[model samples]
Target: MRYRLSIEDMEPNHWVVWVLDLPACFSSAQTPVDAVALAPGRISAYYSWLSSHDSSLPVITESIEVEIVETFHSFASTQDQEYLVNAFFEDDRRPPNYWDVELALRLLQWTRQDLLKVVQSATQEQLSRPMVCEVRGSIAGIIKHIAGAENWYFDQLDLALDRAQLPDDPLDMLKAVRTNTRAQLVKLMGNERITKNCDELWSARKVIRRTLWHERDHTQHIAHLLAHL
Candidate 1:
């Protein structure tokens, strides 16, 4: 099967590769060639893992398109990255039943990881630096906002997870919130009554759409902010 691989240089000899169609699935290698070569196996492994969890296999494409970009500045933003790395499966093409929920979860996971990649190398000063954007806030503030918003949606569904708390380290806070929110979502998926709630505010479809939109929206915000740093 064919897939699209977006390769980015991380350091002098390090590279990271993202399998575009498969959310949260990526691999790293010392060289671009090696990273490209490793992608198919990583993709296969991801499918294996997914099969174990949900008993479904993803459609594999026949060829892969490898697009490489230069190393980002240590604190640079991803605003200018040409590849559409976060593309999710469209609703029209989604499988019926809970499979779409699974896909949404995967997309959310990928969005969180993409956000982390943008800020992972930032120093404290960079993270705290002010940014001029529609969402006016520091990098850390934005991260907190993203995490907090997710928690709020969970709350709307009456999920009992705790609200997101900002920690001394912004990335740590992100990790905690993502873990907690994902756990709650897994629980939500298993509860049909909750998943199929008729109310507009807590319907499973609305929750999934909103969560994905919020995550993707702020992810772009962070990327644009970092680009100006």
Candidate 2:
């Protein structure tokens, strides 16, 4: 039977060719198309040659599941500034590996809160007001941009954004971000080589570390912009 595989469905790390059959299976690398003759007898000869080879195949494991969710804010000043900063400070713990969905989720949540704090502190006006900012567009724009950018990361894990797929309400967005991100993390945990969607943007490390660095990078960007203002 023929099998089809989507880029997102491809296993992380190592080149993997999955068999699109029931129960979900995968295969290792294949030989060059030009290597063998198209003779009927060539097939058995190839298998015999393969059996004679003194080598062992690598072990393949099942995929991990990760869940992702979005967060929304509906606060004036204190809620936006103090609460978010405090929450982020509390959730700053990280797991040794991004393979752990629980740790990744916790770090993601902390980074989200950290971003909100930067937005609250960086904005010139407490309430909604037009002001020229360089990196950060606006307070609301910052929130939306963060949500959208994070969704890109979720897409790498083959999960839909909760805010986009399921609901749009603030509380619901937060819940969805949490759920989907976690599921995605779980999906990739067992992968021996975690494939990163944007290797140019980050190294081949776990997405959790890249995420923290991304948030920190943006925070510094906003800080530089705000400093000039």
Candidate 3:
């Protein structure tokens, strides 16, 4: 399998290589060279992840190839911005079918499970301990950020989740916001409506892409925090 890469240079040490073929899958490293070098491995892992979650996916192949086809420079974080240079793959414009949203929902379920599992074992001390390396400062902060981002994604299309109703506990808030995410996303299953909020564009495909990336990215972030704590 050969996956085309779109590299985003978000500041000096933060480089993200987006696998355009697989919407939600990406690799991050300190430099463009290392980030591109990491793409093939991430592509393989992505396939393994999908196959593990849904047996309907094709059998994994041993060979994986990736080429960097596009690159963009940005100072802002990809999580903060709704758009990336390669954010809208040519593939994304196509109207999604039932199976597209179904598979995405399944992946969502698995990624959230992966996240909760990582955080579930953490002691209260580990959750609250501040870290200089993390922008969100601590595991607990990251959890809230995850839920908040999920809501913000929906609001990009003017489909807002009620903030007043969210729980105070980070984990519970994550659960509540995800329930809202699932409902909104299900409505987008066969609908191809696209809307723009500010300078950014929103579509069902883009929403799914960013939502998956944010949650999965933070899941790894929390795992990293747990490793060093």
Q: Arrange candidates by lDDT, highest first: which order? A: 3, 1, 2
Any runs in candidate 3 off by more than 4 Å, and if so which? 10-12, 51-59, 75-89
lDDT of each: 0.60, 0.38, 0.80
User: When superposed on Cα atoms, how far off is each prediction in RMSD?
Assistant: 12.3, 20.2, 3.5
Q: Model 2 over residues 1-229: C-alpha lDDT tens digits?
A: 1223211111223222221111112222222121111222332332343333323522223333211121112222342443211011111122234435454555556555655566667544631344465344554444444455555555544454644474544334545665666566665544444333322121112344434435544655555655655
Candidate 1's C-alpha runs over 4 A off are: 1-96, 132-136, 164-168, 190-200
Candidate order by decreasing TM-score: 3, 1, 2
Task: Kindly report which residue stretches of model 2 are placed more than 4 angstroms away from their true locations once superposed.
Answer: 1-102, 119-128, 131-136, 162-175, 192-206, 222-229
Candidates in order, TM-scores: namely 0.51, 0.40, 0.84
- Candidate 2 Cα lDDT to native: 0.38
Deviation (Å) of 100 in candidate 2: 4.8
lDDT of 3 by residue, 23-122 (tens): 6799999999998898888888888888887789876676888887877665333555654333454455566678878877888999998998899889
Task: Show how many residue pairs clash in every candidate, following the order shown.
Answer: 5, 27, 0
- Model 1, 53-151: lDDT tens per residue? 456655444554444432322222245343222222222122224665578777676676667778776778988877666364788888877777776
Report how far residue 8 has shifted in candidate 2, in Å. 24
